[model samples]
Target: MKRLLFALTIILALNVALAANVDLDQLDIAKFSLTTDEEKTINFEETEYIITTDSITPSEIKLFFSPNNLVITAKKEKPIEIDLNNDREVDFSLTYLTNLDAVTTIELKKTDLPEDEMDDESSPISDLNPKDQVNDILASIKANLKFLVYAVIVLIVLIIIVKSYKKRANPERLYSKAEALHKEAQEFHKDGDEETAQELYDKAEELREKARDMENSEV
Candidate 1:
């Protein structure tokens, strides 16, 4: 009994060691790139970053932003979008650190928007009232309804064509299906249902014959 207990203890120790040695590099970490032509320059007011990892909790990851000065520890994996600076152009760096010693850093420069371009009146539809905007949206939807109907009809036709082509192309599928039915029929026979089992067997045989004919035609 003592020998058996020692062996079990050794096995448990080995399991614990293996579980603790999980490599972060082997995990599926997503790569991200900025929308700007120059990564060092942040042309947009708001920047977005998507954090992703395989089987790792978001709480294990930490984010640190410098110059703009922001720190966040995520409770869940989601896109991080924030305004770096609203006054003028500024350069900042974002650093991501994981509990598993994985690190990622991104540097960006923000650009200031022109005063005229930043005005809310610059929007084309900003002058329209709420009722007029609703009417315009309804009119646009009504105008597109006929095109939407045509697109749906085309999609349905394509689906039917693809299904028919697959049925013609895959004669082996029928044989595999027939084999499954035969196995089920044998189970039904074992259960003492002779009538149902016979029907199933007959159907299986019919499918098998069809498959054979299709194979011969291909030859």
Candidate 2:
């Protein structure tokens, strides 16, 4: 009875695995647009898409969007609504076949400015009032000041951590000490002091080993 139950479980798992394999060519984007245009831009609150597949059920379909602001799922022929959280235009959408190495991409249309208005070559600064321009400059400086302060703080913290790590395990210092000891050993050997030369060579070897260990630990 136990063997029979195990066989049934394996069959069930295989069936589920087979159901998740979807073909990219079999999937189609039937429709993709905003449900309503409250203004000139596409409405994020009512963005809709209609996806279809030749064999895969809607439950098996998965949807992904970038810059990853929206969380939505695909439904059968029915339209799926998405909230983009802001009025900014969507860049693109991606559809993934779950457990299958298949993907589909859809590029969204960007909001367009009137051609006549965009062709104007006059500088925008010319239209701004002197007082308004000063206020805008001040606001920009204020915003950047906060970011600059945070960046400096982060840099200081990183420098402190790096200095602390080097103090604990300095491979360059170990290597330099090893090289000095090796030179001293060579000089002692040249002077025919065999015992002192051997001792210095042993100390150099130990320092070289410490340097190698420090380098390996970092990796």
Give candidate 1 misplaced runs (Cα > 4 Å).
1-164, 167-169
Q: Residue by residue across 135-179, what tens digits does model 1's lDDT show? A: 655654453445456555655665676677767657788888889
C-alpha lDDT of all candidate models, in order: 0.47, 0.47
lDDT of 2 by residue, 59-104 (tens): 4444433443334555433333334445464422333323222322
Candidate 1: clashing residue pairs, number:
1
Off by over 4 Å in 2: 1-122, 129-131, 171-207, 210-219
RMSD of each: 20.7, 19.5
